[model samples]
Target: MTAPLQGKIAYVTGGSRGIGRASAIAFAEAGADVAICHLDDEAEARTLVQAVTARGRRGFQMAADMGEVAQINAFTAAAEAALGPCDILLNNAGMNIRNPFGEITEAEFDRMVAVHLKGMFFMAQAVYPGMVARGGGRIINIASQLALKGSPGIVTYCAVKAGIIGFTRALAHEAGPRGVLVNAIAPGPVETDLTRARGPEWKARISASLPLGRIGQPEEISATAVLLAGPGGSFYTGACLSPNGGDVMH
Candidate 1:
């Protein structure tokens, strides 16, 4: 039972619940010290920290609104102070506004962009220098299946996610020569709080549409993140792994 990320350090945003929480636990369990940033979910974040510590990995928790650049900077500072230089950055903090294109407002569109694209940009920038100094690091951005194939109603979300994909590719090229690897994952619908709110009927339909005939679990997504962060995926860069259960076959 060798740990792939033994003694590594990872920072995950929106780590209080859903995919971020699962990825944090996976990283810690794989022998990496974990730092998590959450906006308003202190209790859950604390519990996750405890869980990481239980796995014999150091855990750091920070409260920051990732949508704000100032807050992102402060959070990155806190994370660095607590966890030391971040070697693995999981840009998992994201927001979605699902509504008809006609009903979407300017502010709504901006908010969606801010949380996903802007936040991801700043977080990646914050970690780049440290990663470069260490001679290498890994960055994994979380995108969505909708980014590849647009979905109705949430046009803004589709655009932002698409931007993430482009961003991941461009950043991967920029970071690769410096020994860093950047990749993205576009997960299909999962059985999480966000999907649960989409109603039981929609959930059933989505599951039926998938080749696997089932919705994905957070743990499954976390497993992929773990592999990408470890040496096993050192040669993988700018690769957008789609865990969509055959929804978007290329």
Candidate 2:
């Protein structure tokens, strides 16, 4: 049928797996060329690129750690060079260190902030100038349901995600006037490598707790990203869209 983002370009970080991978493909299917970067997983990244190209959209991939400013800059430059200036950006790259608050180390905390908050800041900075010059663009940041309602063991993660929401809202205030829309997505209990690491018992408990009585899939979350990137999200700036399976009803 008709493509909503036919002439657009999307940049997705941590696009080799989970939500990022699914979002990249969904964006391509919606008719945007996609550029993605991964920290390691070259094979998975390559496969994701193949999926994008198979959809008849241009695809670009590279290896870069979002936590490092140099790498983030390099990736943005390379991605824009290969796919042209980004029209949509999904800052989805991140990692978690789940433990009791008392057991959390300084190094672990630093890593979390570096990758989740700092990386998101610069990555958005890298594209903001162009989007402002071009008159508009969309930015979708990934937060977590925990950011709304905290989890016991993932204190740091919850805090960082909460920071993302604040960042999204504050950035929107500045960007909206200039035509760049910024927003955040807070998902609950999705099946990703991170969630899988939480173990089957944890999964069963989380699944049962959600009002939907099931865990979410990556594709389910990606649909939201597509909506935020396409014309449907034209007025969704600075908002936190939660596809949380009734996990955090507000």
* Model 2 CA deviation exceeding 4 Å by range: none
Off by over 4 Å in 1: none
**How many pairs collide in each candidate, listed in order?**
0, 0
TM-score of each: 0.98, 0.99
State how far residue 133 of model 1 sits from its true place (Å): 1.2
lDDT of 1 by residue, 125-189 (tens): 98899899889999999999899999999999999999999999999999999999999989988
lDDT of 2 by residue, 1-250 (tens): 7899999999999999999999999999999999999998999999999999999999999999999999999999999889899999999998998899999999999999999999999999999999999999999999998899998988999999999999999999999999999999999889999889889999999899989999999999999999999989999999999999999998
Give the distance in Å from residue 179's predicted Cα in candidate 1 to where it truly belongs.
0.6
Query: Which pairs of residues collide in candidate 2?
Result: none
lDDT per model vs. reference:
0.92, 0.95
Clashing pairs in 1: none
